[model samples]
Target: MNINLTLIGQSITFLAFVWFCWRFVWPPLLGVMQEREQKIASGLEEAERASKDLELARRKAAEQLKEAKEQAAEIIDGANKRANQIIEEAKNAAEAEGDRLKAAAKAEIEQEVNRAKEQLRSRVATLAVAGAEKILSVNIDAQAHDDLIEKLAAEL
Candidate 1:
């Protein structure tokens, strides 16, 4: 056989084999590789979306907690204000009660002093009559001198 002829035959066979693989075997393999690459890209996209959702959830929870704390503070402030109002009301009531008691006690003391003065005036009037009788050494008509004694008691 001729060397050039054998080389030409081998070259033709190699070309035919390469063309067959390119048309049939290579397309399926490239398709499978492309499909696997698309699947991996979609999976990465899903993972990124899940990460964003988790961050959003955390932010919402933090906002809710802050709102709850503010509400609690407001409630505590309201309660403190109400307590102060109640204390002020109690103080005012106590002051009013004390004033009323003082007024009653003052009135009662005035009444007692008036009664004591009345008794002393009557006693002084009786003693004056007895002294007058002794000085005059005469029987004064007691009933007729009643008006004079009353006037003297009033002056004293």
Candidate 2:
């Protein structure tokens, strides 16, 4: 065998193999690689979008939470104010009731005192008529002497 012929044959075989791969095999392989690269790029873009959406959702949730807290604080403050108003109203009502009771008690006391004074005046007039009758040695008719007793009670 000649060395140059062997070298030439191997060179031609290598060229033929490279040409075959380029024409029949490389196209499908390149296409598959391009499809894989597009899928990867789309997946990366979708991941980035999902991450942004998650961030937006988190921010929105935080804002809502803050608003809820503010609303709750307002509600609590309103409740406190209402409670204070209710308490003040109750206190005012109680005070008014106390004043009314005191006035009623004062009126009742005055009525009782006036009743006692009338009774005492009647008793004193009766006693004075009895003493006058005893001193004059005459029995007094109360119904006939009613006007004198009235005058005497008035004087006392």
RMSD of each: 5.7, 5.4
Full-model lDDT, candidate 1: 0.89
List runs of model 2 lying over 4 Å from the truth. 1-24, 138-156
Candidate 2 residue lDDT tens string, 72-98: 999999999999999999999999999
What RMSD value applies to candidate 1?
5.7
In model 2, how many backbone clashes occur? Answer: 0
Could you tell me how far off, in angstroms, the CA of residue 84 lies in candidate 1 after the best superposition? 2.3
